[model samples]
Target: MRPADLAGVDVLILDRPPGGIAAFDLLETARAGGARLLCDVSDRDHDFEARIAALGLEAARDQANALHLAAVERRAVLALADAILLADPAPDAVLRALGKPLLPVTTPADLKAVLQGGERI
Candidate 1:
């Protein structure tokens, strides 16, 4: 996949690789898959933003009120997206329960398989 395909994508993938890649890798892959990155932060306010900056990813602000809001918004974005990839490992229950086009964040192969087709992955 290529980042150019991300244009007009509504769904955002909060990709959390099993062994995390650099922030830029996440940004590039998500954009390539035709989705935005719904970064899930477990740290102090907007620390994830620093990572985004480090990676040089430009995106609109989507600060969630709470973790649940983050999850819901992520799901909402995915539901509307051509694709959505799960990157956040915590709250596996939330991510898995939402059921809005998901791929395990554990491996690149899983993500590639899922993105190959919107369904049946």
Candidate 2:
């Protein structure tokens, strides 16, 4: 979706790998438009790379490029995020490196609470 489409959005949840540059652009636009950014980093791109290698897939090269782009996009998104949702007991190094507020989310209710402006856990 275009940045204009996020005009009145109160919150934008980035839960998956970015499609490409456009996704990062959209996130920037949404942030500029005053939308709260909540990034859910439940999966790590490096893990996907490892999985592809383990599978002995010929598409590894292309997938690696995409994952690399995703890593870049994720860093940008994290930089703009108001809070981060982490499911893992030990937060990823990226998350810790960025120093953004980390919120542990175990269930859908936790996510809903955060979106609804509930107190940080």
Write model 2 residue lDDT over 80-112, tens digit each, in one string: 788888888588666788888888888999888
Q: Write the per-residue lDDT of candidate 1 for residues 18-119, one digit (tens) a residue.
A: 122343454556667555444332322223333344444334233323433433443444343333344554444444454544444457775555545534
Model 2 poorest ten-residue lDDT run: 46-55
Looking at model 2, residue 119 earns an lDDT score of 42
Worst 10 residues of 1 by lDDT: 39-48
Highest TM-score scorer: 2
Where in model 2 is the C-alpha error above 4 Å?
17-19, 46-66
